[model samples]
Target chain A: MSVQDDLETVEWDVSEDAHITVDNEQCITCEDKPCLHLCPAECFDYQEDQEGGIYFAYEPCVECGACMVFCANDPDKGAVSWSKAEGGKGVEFDFG
Target chain B: MTDVAFDVVVVGAGRAGVAAAYKLADEGFEVALVERAKQPGMKNVTGGVLYGSILDDLVPEFPEEAPLERHVVEHNIKLLHGDAEVSIGYRDLELREEPNYTLILGKFDRWFVDRAVEKGVTFLSETTVQDVTQEESRAVVHTDRENGDIACDAVIGADGVNTTVGRKTGIQRTMRNEDMALSVKKVIDVGRKTIDQRFNLDSDEGAAYIYTGFPQGAATIGYFIYTFDEYISVGAVGGLETLRWLGDEGYGETGTPLYSLLEDFMELDNVRPYVQGDAVEEYQGILVPEHSYDTLPDRHDRRVALVGDAAGLVLNKGYTFRGLDYGIKSGLVAAEAVMECAEDGDWDAFGRRYDTSLEDSYVLQDMKQHRHLPKFLKNERMYDAYPGIATETLRRMYSAETDASGLTWRQAYRAFRRSDAGVLDLLKDGYRGLRSL
Candidate 1:
């Protein structure tokens, strides 16, 4: 099954506010763009038609914090800024 | 909506936070347990096993009262290569009552937090802690809600790997990529009868399987499968350092995200049957601290102490991972340290006592003993050359190529060296294995 299909099995309380935002312009300058690779939820994507070369949606975030850490350690500082979804407003695992 | 005051305010109501809050409340100290999730355990994930002996000291009627999934009676560690596998395992009936059990962290943490609430600890859910500021008279924990500032004598930081307390307090720097790993898991429902027949278990018995050598073995990614009554948790843990190093070849340039690695593992011929189920129950992931003992801070400042991942207490031994137990034990110790210093009316003694108590306890002692494991794990040969050596040697020894005679040990060793690794790689890894293990 696709990742989108896999994500459907878990529960999420989507928030109107984006808990994580990506500075796409900064991401283009990033040489490695590790978030495109490291995120377990595949929340970060590369989209050529976008203003910058990246696409990010916080809706499917499992709140693992990999993107935040990996991006912050990159040479370009970090294009991604992350915080937890307001309490009770993100992924909630029924069987973690 | 008024600002509340308590003797102790514990952050992140997972295993560590609840442990500290429960003990302090039992000791007659007013405690507040702040949680980020709507309920305890919703935001947490582990490899699905809890070493519960340490928990018995705090809750006497444990294994009986806990929300456990299964009693782990079998343990296996296997090395995988392509379609081949080599494993060693042990099963003991005595293990059914103590030491280890399979559980869902979401269910277990909620039950544990409920116990703390019953002990008179003020439980606050759906409240996010913004930051904390310390003043001369007391420590003030700031939260995101109206009048959410909590005044307290002390704070116990039990938040997970991405700790707000660690960063805001300046006690921990950003974790190095080498020191952390990304673990993604999926819980599958295949029914109790399927679990019994597939895993060869009785109604209450469970099995834990650990597999290494995947993603071509260069990345040191490990996979785990644990049997729950009617579900199984399957996942993979890949080191950040190696994943980044692999770069285009491993994570990004090659278009292989960490989650896809779990997919690849699940589809493997050897692993498919065990995990094939009616449906995927839940998908989850978390950042794990690995081989971090040396870099861990003192874990305390005057009235604020840290426990669990916030204190960098997780240990990733090559064959097994131990975090929940350490988190629980440290929470208990942090509570003891708080009570001791409070009785003496000396907050300055908090650090010394917390550190000394951990050193005297098994938590820190075990970490100190395996302090060099991170360095040992970095040797690429452990993931690549070693598994190849074992699988190739076995294949050569068992094949009946020649008419009658079987291959000798020396012949198999020669063929193995010819296929993948060399003498020097073997010697270096063998010696290092002896020293590290």
Candidate 2:
């Protein structure tokens, strides 16, 4: 099964508001978008339609902070801004 | 900074944050704990094993009401190449008690935070710390909520692997992908009876198994399986570069995405049977501070000290996992340092004692001992070639059928090396592994 399929197996409490945002322009310049490659959540996807840009979402995020941590280290500063969603929001683990 | 301040403010109510808050409060220092999650442990996850004698110091006895899953008495490490595998394990009754627990963070941290709460620690849950600024006499913590800013004599940034509080204190700079290991874990519901029979454990006894070199596995990735109460936690993690390699390799060896590698590992003959009808309980991913110890974030900086993943204290001792132990231990150490500064009434050099105290503890020493391990692990041959060498050689040696006049152990060993690795490379790895591990 795909990661999405496995993710479907686990319960999720999706937050309407997002705590993370990406600067797509900066991402276009990023030689290798680590978030698209490494984020287990698959929150960021490469959308060639936007001139080889990225399609970003935070609802599926496991809130592990990998995406933010990776993006922050990029020389293209401020490409990704991350924070924990407001209290009682974001992905909550049942058996974390 | 507002006048609404305490003696100490511990950021993030994780293992380290709670530990520091508990110790500080018991010492009669007014402590404030702010957690981004609605409650403690809600935002936390770990391929967690609480080994070593650290938690005993925090909670004399983890209350029976505590959600401690199991006591891991068996240490199993294996090398998997396809369905066939080789593992060497040790199970001891003496090591089954306190501190050696299989913890589910969502439960354990709640129980632990309560212990701190009883000591008069004021907890601010569902509060996000916006920024932390260190001043001459105290550190000011600004929160997203109104009147949430707190001024404290000291700040303990146990906020976890993604460090803002740490960077604010200048204790940690920008963290690179090379400095972390990324993982996605699933808690599968294999019945208690199935777990017991499959893992060969008595009731409440758990086994942690680490496997390397599965069919699609590389030198950088490791698959971990742990029997957790009614759920079996199975997962994988590797260095950032290695994961990048997996990403670079389109379709990988499994001819699918990276997650497919995990499903593939699970579907193998040896793995598939154990969890055939098991349900998937939970799935999540985390970025852990398993970077080489040399890249460890500064332990403390002036009035602001770091602990847990924020401090980059997790040690990836090859297959063995140890993070929460250091996270909790350093909380106690951070508490001691914070108290010393509070007594002296000096916030500038407040946590100066943390460096020396950690040096005196086994935490720093353990990281120091295995400082070279990260580089050793990067040597792809160890994971790529070694597991195959070990399993195949053992397979040929153990087979009772007379195959080519039944080679001796020494001859079989040479033959295994002949296939994948040469003698020189194997010797080099052994020498490096010895010095590093």
Specify the highest-TM-score model's number: 1
lDDT string for model 2 (B1-437, tens) is 39597989998888888988998888898999988777678788889688746766567666355688888888888777655687889889988554587888888888888888999999888777778887776789988787878998888888888866877667787777677777888888888988889878897998888877754347667878888888888887766656665634332221123465677778887777655654777788888776676777676777888888888888877668888888888888988888777677666776678877977778888989998997897776766577766766776677765363555676567666576678888788899999997
* Candidate 2 - chain A - TM: 0.87
The parts of candidate 2 lying over 4 Å away from their true place are: A9-17, A30-32, A76-78, B1-3, B63-65, B215-217, B247-257, B400-407
Per-residue lDDT for A1-96 in model 1, tens only?
Answer: 767788888788898999899877787666666776778777877788865567898998999888877886555648888787786788888787
Interface RMSD of 2: 3.5
Candidate 1 per-residue C-alpha lDDT over B1-437 given as tens digits, one digit per residue, 9 for 90 to 100:
33789988999988888988999999999999998788788888888468889888799887888889899889888888777887889889888767588988878888999899999999999888878777786888888778889998888899888888777887677776776888888888889999999999997899999888786665568899999988998988888866776635443464456677788888899899898875888888899887545776657777778899888788777667788889999999999998997898786667568878988889888887777677777776777777777777777667576332445677666656665567877787677767665
Error of 1 at B91 (Å): 1.7
Model 2 DockQ class: medium
Which runs of model 1 end up more than 4 angstroms from their true locations? B247-255, B402-408
